[model samples]
Target: MHAVLKLSKYLKPYKHFAVLAPILMILEVAMDLVQPTIMQKIIDDGIVMNNTLYIVGMFIVMIACAIIGWLGGAGCNFFSSKAAVNFAADIRADLYETITYFSNSNKDKFTLGKLITNLTNDVEMLQRALNMLLKVFVRGPFMFIGAVLVVFFTARDLFPILFFVVPVLIICLYVFIKLSITLFRKVQEAIDGVNTRVQENLSGIRVIKAFNRMRHQVKQFTGVNEELTKRNMTADQVIAALMPITQFVVNIGIVLALMLGVVKVEAGANEIGVIVAFINYLMMIMNGLMSSSNVLIQIARAIPSAERVVVVLEEQPDITNAENPVKKEILGDVNFEHVSFSYNKQVEPVLKDISFEAKAGSTVGIIGMTGSGKSTLIKLLARLMDVDEGTIYIDGFPIQQYDIETLRNAMAFAPQKATLFSTTIEENLKYGKSDATKEEIKEALVASNAIEFVEKLDKKEQHELTQGATNLSGGQKQRLAMSRALIRKPKILVLDDTTSAVDSITEKMIQKNMKELKGSTKFIVSSKISSIQHANLILVLEDGRIVAKGTHEELLKTSEHYREIVATQVEKGGILHE
Candidate 1:
């Protein structure tokens, strides 16, 4: 209920319609309540007296009330739907915007499957629940209360039936709601599990096929699907008993009312018309009770979804701009001052007391075995994740002091895994520099060695790329990623093993071309020593600590790790000396 209140702001814009919808529903309930009295009047006054004119007039009044009820229902439906659709749109847009600004660390807090379910499934559930709330919730209460009042004023002797039946129905509804709430939450969790399985299988289908794990994957999916089905059935089973019990209670009340009415009529104490009208009101009350119970059950089911949405909406971005942030051109002079970082505080640090400096226009090389914090070090340089201890500076200014976009926009980073979207090659290149010209694109392609393969395609730069660049080979994808970084002409360029997939010859060509790039300071993280041997500075890292830092020739003599790496990759062959 508190979560519902939090989201009430989404209804603020539609407040007029929101207010109007309930008012119209009240009118519909009024029309419904009037029909029973009209029926009683037609039967007792017109039919008993054989008054044709009176019968006609009563029939005309009933018809007008029916039309009014119909118009009111139609208006309520329109406003409810309008409010629901607009409310959902607003929430969905905000969720996506919040996700867009999420820090890498914040993103790790929620799974991709869970987030998708919140955006699509949970939001959809809220939309439907809001519609029901506006329509059924309002109508049920007004109709139930109105019917009760009318029946009491018309036939006071039978009001005890309402007392007995309504209480039973209320008790049954309470127990049903309590049981269903827990079950509904489990049902939603089961849905997340199913979605998680589907998300993973779809994303990793190629690997599943390559490893011949189709049957195993199917078995895993079957387990999640079965859990979802079982939970849904459990929720349904708990509430399934509700309808029959409610009907039995209402039927008993109606029978008692009819029996008492018959006794009163035998004593010539009641008219048949009034008794019939009382029974009609009782039925209306029964329908209202049942409808209200269904609406409450729907509300119970949607509560989990509402909480999920609120979780995202309430989340503040872990990384945000500081007040009065400095926005300036970075000179590419980067320094790490005793910087240390960990993905989580409970775990061992990924980078430990790491400190280094790269002058403007110098190439700083990083080499380590897998999990030596090579990629983590590069990410810290780009401010992707803030350091847990110490500080990093660009051009002698603290990285945090600068505006985030200003800091990132001045640097170009090609990650270890090359990712390309579903679009034309030209569009992909322009992602780094939106207004890149043909000549600049050509220059970037030449520098990255992507121009050769791109030229072989019929469309040249216009060639379309499949999702993740599956249409291109590994080397082609790497070169294109590199080209994207290079086209920006950034002051700082960080390539995290971007040449791993390319052959030694192409790797040499890329390195040579990058050396020709005049102003950009480059940080290259690579396993192959040959790739970084010519850098102005080379840092050998092991177990999250920098073990050696010097020019390639200086480290070759002073560091055993450098010597071993040189000895290992020397046979693979590139010139090792200046």
Candidate 2:
């Protein structure tokens, strides 16, 4: 409930609409309350006296009141809709912006499916609740209190009927609302489960097909879908029962009112017109209670949703720019002094006390077995994940001293997995350097050995790639990804096994073209010895430690591990010794 209240700040921009909606709804309620008194007058004064003119005059007044009430209700609906819709839109936009700033570690805390649900489903629930609150919340209490006061003053004997009816309805509302809230929370969790299952299946549809497990995936989806359906039915059943119970209580009250009215009329203590007006006010009171019940049901659903949205809204990104950050150009003189990191503290460190240096404009190659932290090492250098221990320096200053964007902008990182958007090839290249000219794009394509195939395409750079670049071959995707990085002509370039999909000859050609960026520092992480043999410095890693570091010829002479790696690759005809 507190979480829901916190979101009210989003309504500040729409305060005019928010304010007008309830005010108009109150006016409508006032108009509705006036009708019972007018009816009492038409019956007691006009009908009892047999005055047709008086009855006609009061009838015309009733018609005017109805028109004003209708206008008020319509205005309330219009204003409430505007305020709720804009409030939701602003919240949705802020949620997206917050997600974009989430660090890798922060992203790990939330699944893709759960985040989607928070942004769409949860926010929508709050929107609906706010809309109902503006209209029903204002109308219900005003109508209830107004009816009660009118009945008490004009028909004091009949007012005691409300004492019995109101308490019974209040008890039922409290019980139903409590039961529904717990069930609604479960329903929301079940929805999250369904979304997660669907997201996983869609993202991995290819893998499922390749493994011939389509039936298995279908079974899993069905289980979650059934769970969601069951939870929804359970929550709705509780709320559905509320309407019948409320109607039963009101019906009993109506019967009692009729019996008491007959007794009073026979005793000549009450006029028939007064009895008729009392019944009308009683119905109005019941209508007000029903409106309250409807709003409570919405609140039960919205409470859970508001909490979920607040979690995202209140989540502070683990990575943020320093208050007084240095936003300066980076020269890419890199140093890792006793750096160590682990994804989980309970697990063994992936990189342990790793100390190394790469001078500006140097090419350093890293070769290691699978899971030897080659990729993890470079991720630290880019500050995707901060080190658990020690500091990483760039240009003789700690990396944290620089603004995150400025530091990241100084380097271009082409990861092992090629990620490309569903856009034209030229637009994808422009992501690296938004203002890049056609000639610069062509140069990057040529350097990455992607020019030959891209030139052969009918539309060349204008050709549209499918999502994840699925339309292109693996090697082609890798080439385009490398080209995207190379287009930046960054001060530091880190290529993590970027050419593994290309042939050895093509890889060699790409490596040759890389020399054109002579002033940039480069770190190439690869499994192939041939890829790094010409590097100014080569690092051989094992068991999360740099066991050997030297030029290829120097390492081959002095390090047994380096010699064995070269020997194995040479025998397999995977390396071309220069």
Candidate 3:
């Protein structure tokens, strides 16, 4: 309930519709309540007295009431729909924004599958609940209470049947509500499990196919699907039993009411029309209770969804702009002073007491074996994750003192795995700088050595790439990603194995182009010795420490690890240093 209440802020903009919907629903219910009384009048005052004029007058009035009821119901539905859709839209927008701004650790904590489920499936549940609130939730109680009030005024004796029936039905509903809450939570978990499996499978489809694991994948998916189906069926069975149980209790009340009515009529305690109207009121009350039960079932399901959404909404990002942010432009120089970091506090640090400096406009190369913290170091420099100890500075100021946007805008980074959206080549490049002109985009492509193949295509930069850039070659994707980073004209450029997929000739050409880009500091991380040997300063990393920091000529003579790496690559004839 608290979680659901938190979402009420979303209703502020649509409060007018939210308020109007219930008002219209009350009018509709009032119209419905009057119809039975009018029928009673026609039967007793008109038909019994053979007064045709009175009967026509009552029927016309009843028709007008029915028309008004129709209009009121329509108006209620219109307002309810508008409020519900806007509420959902606002939540989805906020959720997307929250995700986009999440720090690396925060994102890691939530995980991709859970976030997707919360945004899509959970938000949908809340939307349905919103619609139900203004529709049946309000109308149901109004009908139930109004019927009871009218029956009490017209036939006080019918109260006995309600007293006997309502308590038993309430007890049954309470039990169903309790049981449904637990079952619905399991249903939502099953949905998350299914979504996780599907997301994993889709992302690794190529690996599954390459290893001929299609049958294994199918078996794994079937397990989750069956679990989801079983849980849903169990929940549905529990909810399905509710209607029959409720009906049995209401039917007994109906029988009792009829017996009492018959006796009253015979004893001249109540008129036949009054008895008929009382029975009609009893049915209306039963309909209202049943509608309320359905809404409760929906609420039970929505509770878990609401909790999930609240969890996302309430999360505060660990990284944010400083209180007094500085927006000065970066000068390409970077310094790390006694920096250390760990993904988790309980675990050993990934990077340990890492300290280095790269002058503006210099090429700094980072080479390490797998798990040596090459990527982690880059992440710290970009402020994607903060250091466990010490500080990283851009130019002369600590990176934390700068506004986050300005700090990030100063550096352009390309990761080991190149990612491209499902869009045109020009649009992908512009992601680095949205306002980049045609000439700047062409220059970026030329610098990255991507213009060769791009010019061969009829569409050139307009060529559309598929999801994950699967439509393009691995080398082609790398070039496009590099072009995207270069187009920003950043003060500092970080490339993490960006050219590993391309041919050696193309890689050297890219290296040549990097040297030509004046005043831009470059940090290149690669496994290939050839890629980093030309740097003004090369840092050979092992177990998160700088094992050697020197130019290629100095490292070859003084560092055994650097010598071994060069010897290994040269023995394979894969690379050679000039």
State each candidate's clash count.
0, 0, 0
Worst 10 residues of 3 by lDDT: 569-578
Per-residue lDDT tens digits for candidate 1, residues 1-578, read 77888888999998888888988998899999999999999999999989999999999999999999999999999999999999999999999999888888777788777888889989998889889989999999888999999988888888888889998888999999988778998988988898989999998999999999999999999999999999999999889999999989888988999999999989988888989999898888888988888889988998989988898888888877889988988889999999999998999999999999899999999998899999999888777889999999898888888899999899998876888989999999999899999999999999999998999999999999987788998889999999999999999999999988998788888989988998999999999887888899999999999999999879978999888888877766645433
lDDT of 2 by residue, 1-578 (tens): 68977888899999999999999998899999999999999999999999999999999999999999999999999999999999999999999999988878877798878888989899899899999999998898899899999999999989899999999988998899898888989988988888889889887888999999999999998999999999999888888898898889988888888899899989999888998898899888888988988898888889999998889889998777778988878887999899999999999999998888999999999999999999999998878888999899999888877899999898998887899999999999999999999999999999999998999999999999998788999899999999999999999999999988989889989888876677789999999987788888898989899999999889988999988888888898876635
Question: lDDT (CA) for every model shown?
Answer: 0.90, 0.91, 0.90
Could you tell me which 10 consecutive residues in candidate 1 have the lowest summed lDDT? 569-578
Residue pair clashes in candidate 3: none
Tell me the alpha-carbon RMSD of every candidate: 2.2, 2.1, 1.4
The 10 consecutive residues of candidate 2 with the worst lDDT sum are 569-578
User: Which candidate has the highest TM-score of all?
Assistant: 3
TM-score, ranked from best to worst: 3, 2, 1
Q: Where in model 2 is the C-alpha error above 4 Å?
A: 45-51, 571-573
Quote each prediction's TM-score.
0.94, 0.94, 0.98
- lDDT score of residue 378 within candidate 3: 91
Could you give me the TM-score of model 2 versus the true structure?
0.94
